[model samples]
Target chain A: MSDNITKGKMIKPENLVYTKSRVMTDNVTSYCPGCGHGTAHRIIAEVIEEMDIQSEIIGVAPVGCSVLMYDFLDLDIQQAAHGRAPAVATAIKRLMPEKFVFTYQDDGDLAAIGTAETIHACNRGENIMIVFINNGIYGMTGGQMAPTTLEGMKSSTSPYGRDVATMGNPLKMTDIVATLPGTYYVTRQSVQKPANVRKTKKAIRKALEYQKLNRGTCFIEIVSNCPSGWKMTPVESNKWMEDTMFPYYPLGDFKVPEED
Target chain B: MERELRLMKGNEAIAEAAIRAGADGYFGYPITPQSEVLEYLTMEKPHERTGMIILQAESEVAAINMVYGGAACGKKVMTSSSSPGISLKQEGITYIAGAELPCLIVNVVRGGPGLGTIQPAQSDYFQATKGGGHGDYKLIVLAPASVQEMADFVELAFDLAFKYRNPAMILSDGAIGQMMEKVWLKPQKERSREFPEWATTGKTPDRERNIITSLNLDPNKQEDFNHKLQAKYREIEKNEVLYEEFQCDDAEYLFVAYGTSARVCQKAIELAREEGIKVGLLRPITLFPFPTVIISRLADQVKGILTVEMSAGQMVEDVRLAVNGKIPVEHWGRMGGIVPTPEEAVENLKSKIIGG
Candidate 1:
C-alpha cells in the first residue's frame, strides 16, 4: 500500500476531499479574519447540509456580529432583539413544531442582556436549539467586557481589569442552563484547531439530531476567540484562551439525556 | 345558526375573539386587569380547538418578543398587558414596528406614572398614539368602549395589522377589561391561506430567504426607511380615522373622549343636554388617527370642546390640536384612578365652559 501511494500528488476526481457546504452561500462572512464565528457558522451550515434540513430550518440571529447569519447561511433567519433569541425561537418552534429552529447568539447577547430569556427557555424545555458563542468580550461594540469575561481580564469597559468584588464574577451560564430540567442536551466546546473544529461539528450534528427525538432544549456553547477585541494576534489570542479561558470555562458536556 | 350571545369580561372577550379570529399564538404574562386575558386563554385551551399557541411568558418583555417571532413568520399573534407590563414590552414593540411585522398588542391601562393604581385610566393615550418606543413609528390604535368592540376589534386589529404590515394596539382600560357585558362572538374565521412572501417561514427554493430585523446601520438608509414609514402613516391617517358622532347634529358644545371615558362622556352629554347645554359627544374609535378631521369639523360647529379622560389631561392635548384654536378647548380629568361620574362631568362643563 505504501509503495503504490505517491506523496504530494493530486488525487483523482472521485477522490476529491472536502468542499463548501451547499447550505452556505458564496458570500464572504462579515466576521474578522481568525475570528471563531466564521468557523462556528461553517459548522452549523455543514451540519444543516449533512442532515438535509436546509429547507425546514429557521435561524434566529442575535444583535451582535452574527446578526447577518442569513447572509452566509441559506436557511431562513429572523433577527431578534438583543438577548431575545430564545423567546423568539420558542415561538418559531412552537408555531411550527416540525421545523428545526435554532438561535445563534453571543456571550453578551446570551448571558448578559438575555439571561432571563435563556434560563426560562431552558426551564420550559422548548424543543429548539441554541448556539451560544462565548468570546469573553463584546466584539461588535468595540471590546466591551461581557458577562463571560474572565475575572482579571481587561477590556474596553474593564480597563482596570475585572474586579470580581465589584464587577461580579464571570457568569458560568452553561452550568446554570444545564441544571434546568427542561434541557435535554447541554454541552460546551471550542474550535481553535482542526481537531477541535471537527469535534464542534459533531456536537452541532448531535444537537440537530436530538431535535428528531422531540426532546427539550439543546444548548451548545462555543468558547470562541475574539482577537481584535482581546487586543492580541490570532495566534496569541488562541494561546491566551487555551491557557486562561479553558481553565475557567472548561470544555465538556454539562448535561445530556441518558441513553435508553 | 344564530350567533350566540354570552356575558364575558372585556379581557375574556379579547381571548375568545383572538381564538375565533384564527390567531396563531397568544404570548402574555399575568398582570392586574389584563391577567384575565392570559388566564382565559390558558384555561380555554385554544391549542386544542385551533392549534393556537398559548405560552405564559416569563415576563412582558419575553411575551412581546414571542409575538414578534410568531408575527415574523406571518402568523397572527397577540399579547395583552396592563400599563406597567406594557412599559416593559416597549423595547420589543419598537423592534416589531421597525421590522414592520404585523401583530396585535392589547394594553388594558391602569393608573400609571409609576405603579400608581390598578384602576382604569387612559393615561397611556399619549404612549399609544405617539410612538411608545424609540423610533419614527406609529401603532394603529383602536379604542374599544364596549365588550362587543373588544370582541370585534380582535379581528379588526389583526386585519389592520396585516393590512399595513404594522403593529396594532387595542388601548383598553381596567374598567372595560374587568367589566362583564354581553358580546356576540363572531364565528371562527379561517386563517389566511396566502402567507406573506416577506415572512421568515423556512425558505423554499422558489424565493429568497426573509429576514425580520430593525437594524439599519447606515444613517442615510435608515432615514429613507423613516420617510417611507411616515408616508405609510400618512396613508393610514387619510384612510383609517374612525369615530362615532352621538347627537352632534346642531349641538353647541362637544365632548371629546375615548375608551371608558367615552362611555362616561356619553352619559354626561345626556345630562348636559337635559340641563340645556346643547351638548354632543365625539367618541374616537381610532385614537392614532385622532379623528382630527371630525374634531376639526365639530370645532367649527360647537362653541367649545370639553375633553374628559381618566388621566391627567393626555388626550385633551390631541383634542386641542384638532380644535386648532378655532374654539375654546378645555380638559377635565380625574387622576389616580378617580373616575369622574356623569354628574361630575356635567358640573365641570357647566362651571368651566358655560360659566366662563
Candidate 2:
C-alpha cells in the first residue's frame, strides 16, 4: 500500500504519468511497464533539452514504436517509411548540411529492412545522428523474432527459442557499424539502471554535439528491455537485460574519432 | 538579344541551353541518342568558380537521385537520358514528385516496349503523360518538336517547374534528339521565383529546422494533402497549356501530332496545301495539359482529324475524347523504330478526310 512498492508496479497510477524531466509533450505514452523505449525516449528528450538544440534539431522517426514520436517531440520531426529513415535522413542532411539531423530506429528497422540504406548512409559519412534501439524482438508486431533476437530467446515466432545453428547468429549492428570509416562515433549503452541511463544520456548528448559540429556519422545503440514480449514482470525484465543481453551485447563505446 | 547561331543536335542543344539557362548542376548518364547531352556538357567548360556541377553518374537512377538531392537544396538541377535509361529513373522521379521538388528531366525517347531499337519513335507518350511511376501524379510533359523548341523549352520547362514546384519533362524522340538544326541561345538571368522560405536550407542562428517529407499517416491530413496536390494541378492546367496551330483557321481536316511527329506533320501541311486540300496541324507543346480546348474547338470546324504519330496511336485517344464523337478522329502510326514520313502523314490525312 506504500508509495515505493506501488510506484514502479504495473497497477500504480502515478507510474502512468511520464517524467517531467523530459521534453515530451502531453501525449500519452503507449508503452507497457518496463518497456525500455520510454526510458530511451526520456533520455533523448532530456539530452536535447540540456543541449538547447531543440529549436534546430530535426529527428527522423522510424516505423516501429517510435513512429509516433513526431507527436511527442517538441521539435521538427520527419516520419520515414519502415527502415528507410537512414535514406530519408541522408537526403535531408545532404540538402541542408547545417541542420542537426538524427534518426531513431528499432532493431528491425535498422538491421533488417533498412540494412542497405543504414550501411550506405554510414559509409558516406553523412553528418547525422542515429539512436538505434535494440530490444531483441519486434515488440510492435507481437513479439516476432527480430534480427537482433538473442540465441535461445523465446518469442511468438520462435516458440522453442532462437537456435543459432538454424536461425543464424544475432546481428551485432554496433560492431558492424564500427568497422565503417565514415562512422565517427559508435557506442552501445543499456537503460537497465539509473546510472546507465545517465551514461546513455551523456552518450546521446555527445553524439548530437558531434553532429552539430559537422563531425561525421554518430551512432548510439541502446539495449532495452521489453517486459510484455519477454514474458517477465517489469523487475524481472530489467534483471534479464542486465544478466543476459548486456553480456552478449556489451555496453561501451566502440569507436570515436579524434577530437577537433 | 540575339546570340550566336549554331547548328546543333537536339541533345547538344538541350545541354548547352541548360548551361545558358543558369542551371547550377547537371547530373546525367550517357545513353544512345542522348549521349550528346553529356558530351556537350563535358566538352564545353562553363565558368567553374560559380559551381556549375556536371557529373556523369554511375547510373540513371543515381543521376535523378542527385537531381533530387540538389533540387531539395534550392539548386537548378537537371538530368537527361534515352528511353531505356529513363526506365531506371522512374523511381527517383516518383520520389521527387512525392517530395514536390522542382527539377528537370529530359528523355530522348526511342522505339520501345523494351530495348526495341535506338531509332526514333514516340512510344513513351503514355509514360510521359499518365504518371510513369505509381501513384496519382503528373509531370509537366513538354514535347519539343524541333531543335529551336529544344533550346527554348529547356528554360521554359525550368521556369514552369520552379513556378509550380513540380518536375518538368522535355519528351523528345531520337530524330529530334540527334538531327542538326539552327538555334539562338539566350541566358536565363534570374530564377522565376525566389527560393521559398520553407526550402530545406540549414537553420540559421535564429530559425528552427526545416524538414521536407511526404509522410501523412492521419487519413484526414492525407486527404488534405491529396486535395492540395489536385488544386495545384488544376492551376497548372489553367496556366501552362501550350500548343501551336498551323493553318487551322478555316481548315476542314486537321492533323494532330507532337514532338518529332509534329515536324513531319508540318511538312505534310505544306504538301496538302499544294494538293488543294485544306489540311492544318495542331501540335501540342505541353502534352499533359493536352490542349483539349483546341481539339474541342477544332472538332466544331473540322469534319475529320488524323493523328499522325511515330508509334502506336496514343494521343489519338485524347483527341477522340476531346472531340467527344462529334468528328471522326482516326489514328495512323508506324511502330518499332520507323519514322512516318511527311508523305505518309499526308496520305493518311487525305485518305481519312477525302476517302471518308
Candidate 3:
C-alpha cells in the first residue's frame, strides 16, 4: 500500500480505484496459487465491508483446505469438524438470531463427508449463507475423488479415472439444493474471469442481505480450480476449468426468491 | 427460597433443570433411554418462558456440532443421547474439547459394543471418563445415581464446564432415566447476555477477532497448548473430586461403585450389615476425578474392596488404580443389560472379596 504512495505515484485514498478491504487481515493466505479460495475470501470480505456487517457476522470454516480461514478474515470464526460447518452455523444462527452466520466449505467437505449436514441444514431452511467451492476434487488431502468429481476425472484415489458406473453420477449440489424448498437463493458462480469474480461478489452480498430477511438458506456454489492439486499451471488450470469443469458445473443462478 | 418440587424421571429432571439453569440452547438428537429429555423440553415449551433455543438435529453428529457452535459463542448449551448416539458424537466431542469450548453432554447410557441393548449398562465408563474421542482430552464426568442428582448435576456440569473452559458430561443410565423420583428443583436463573472474552461473538472495535478452533499446524505450539490443558485438568482434579461414604466409619470391607450400581451397593451394604458383616459402600459421584484420594486412604483402612457396576468391571480398573495394590481389589458384575440386584450384589461382594 505504501509502495504505491512512496513510489512517487502519490495514489491518494480518493484517487484509489481499489484497495484491500479492512475486513481482511494482514495475514498471508495459505491457499495455493491460482486456487479460487483467496479471491473468494477477499470478495466476501469486500462484501462484508460494503454491507458494514463486519461486527455482526460469524463465519464457520469447514475442515478442508480452507480450515485456516479465520487467520485471514478479520471477523469471528468457528472452525468446524469435517462436513459439520452447516450444523455449527445452524446453532449459531438459532442461538443468536440477530447475528449473521455462514459456512465456507469445499466439495469434499460439503458434498461428501458433510452431505447430511448440508442437505438437512438447507432442508430445514436455516437462515444462513453457504459458500461452497466445488473444485470436484479433495485438494487438502491430496486430490482424492470427491462426490462431485466429474465422470472420467482422474483423482489420486481414482487413478483409473472416475468410472460413472461404479462411482455413480457427479453430485450437482447447487442444482440439488435449488430444488429444495428451504433454499431461498441458490447460484453457481466462478472466478476464472474478472466478470465472474464481480458476479460472485454480488451473489455473496445478496446472500448476506437475504439472510437478514430470515426467509431461508442462501447457497452459492463457486466452481473453482486447483492448480497444484490438478497438476497444472495457473494458466493451464484456468483453461482446464473452463474446458472441462464448466461443461458439467455451469455458472449461473439456479434459484431466486419471488419478487416482493 | 421457594423450591419447585416435582416427581419426574431422571431424564425429565435433566431437561427441566437445564431450562431452569438459564441455558442458552439445547441441540440434541433423540435416542433411547434419553429421548424423554428432548421430549420433556419440547413439551414444556421453555422457549415461551426463558427464550432458550431447542433444536432436534438430524443426527447425533449434527447435534454435537451444533453444541460446538453454541459453545463457541460462550453460551450454556447441551445435548443428550444414548450410548450409540454418544458414540456417533465422538468426533464433534473431541473437537469441542480440543478447542477448549464449554458445553454439556448428557449420556443416558444403554448397553453397547455395537447397538447391544436398550437396557442400562456402565460400559461407557471407559468411553466417557477416558475420552471417547481420538485425542488426549477429558470431560468433567458426573455420575448421577438418582433423579434428584440428575436434576442437580445439569447446572453443576455447566458451571464447571465454563469455569474451566472444558466440556462436561452427566453420565446416567436407563434405570435412573426411566425411574421416577421426587426432586426439589432450584429456582430459575436469568440467562446471561454478557459474552465471555474468548467467545466468537463478532469482532467489535474493542477486541480482536475471536477464533474458536483446535487446528494448530505447529507442533511446538500444539505441545504447549497440551501442557496448558493438562494443567487445567490437574487443577480440576485437585478441586472437583466428589464421592459419598455410607457406613464406612467402622467397616472392614468396602464396595466401590457408581451410578445404578452404587444404589445396588447401598442396598447390599444394608443386607451385609444385617448379617453382622462390617461392609460399607463408597460411591463416586465424579467419575473423571475418580475420588482417588479418598479411595487410596480407605484402601489403608479396609481389608478389601469389591468394585461393582452394571458393566463387566469397567470402573473396577479405575478402582484398582486408585487402590494401587494396597489391598485386595476385585470386580464383579453382570453385563448385557442386566442391572445387578441387591441380593446378587451382596453375594458377589462376599464371594469376590470376603471368601474367594
Best by lDDT: 3
Model 2 lDDT tens row, B1-356: 23669899999999888888888778788889789999998888653523366766556765676676667666788999989998878877877787788889999999988888999889888888888987778899999988998999999999898888899999999999999999888744543244566554444445544555566668898788878878888898899899999999979899999988888899999998999989889999999878999899999998899998888899999999999999899999999889989999888887776697
Judged by DockQ cut-offs, is candidate 1 incorrect, acceptable, medium or high? Answer: medium
lDDT of 3 by residue, A105-224 (tens): 999999999999999999999999999999989999999899988999899988999999998889999999998999999999998889999999999988988999898999999999
Strongest candidate by TM-score: 3
Q: How is the predicted docking of candidate 3 categorized under the CAPRI scheme?
A: high
Q: What ranges in model 3 sit over 4 Å off?
A: A1-10
Q: Write the per-residue lDDT of candidate 1 for residues B1-356, one digit (tens) a residue.
A: 13569999999999999999999999999999799999999999998888899999999999999999999999999999999999999999999999999999999999988888999998998899899999789999999999999999999999999999999999999999999999999887766656788988787888877878898878999999999999999999999999999999979988888888889999998888887889999999999877998899999998988899998898889888888899988889888877789999998888777776
TM, every model: 0.97, 0.80, 0.98
Interface RMSD of 2: 4.5
Better of 1 and 2 by lDDT: 1
Scanning candidate 3 chain B in windows of ten residues, the lowest lDDT window is B1-10
- Model 3: per-residue Cα lDDT over B1-356, one tens digit each: 24799999999999999999999999989889899999999998888989999999999999999999999999999999999999999999999999999999999998878989999999999999999999889999999999999999999999999999999999999999999999999999989989899998888888899999999899999999999999999999999999999999999999999999999999999999999889889999999888999999999999999989888788889889988999999988879889999998888778878896
lDDT of each: 0.91, 0.83, 0.93
Off by over 4 Å in 2: A1-48, A54-56, A61-65, A79-88, A106-113, A134-177, A190-196, A212-215, A223-251, B1-49, B52-99, B114-120, B174-182, B188-195, B202-211, B350-356
Interface RMSD of each: 0.8, 4.5, 0.5
* Residue-wise C-alpha lDDT for candidate 1, range A200-226, written one tens digit per residue: 899888888898779989999999999
User: What is model 2's native contact fraction?
Assistant: 0.13
Model 2 clashing residue pairs (backbone): none
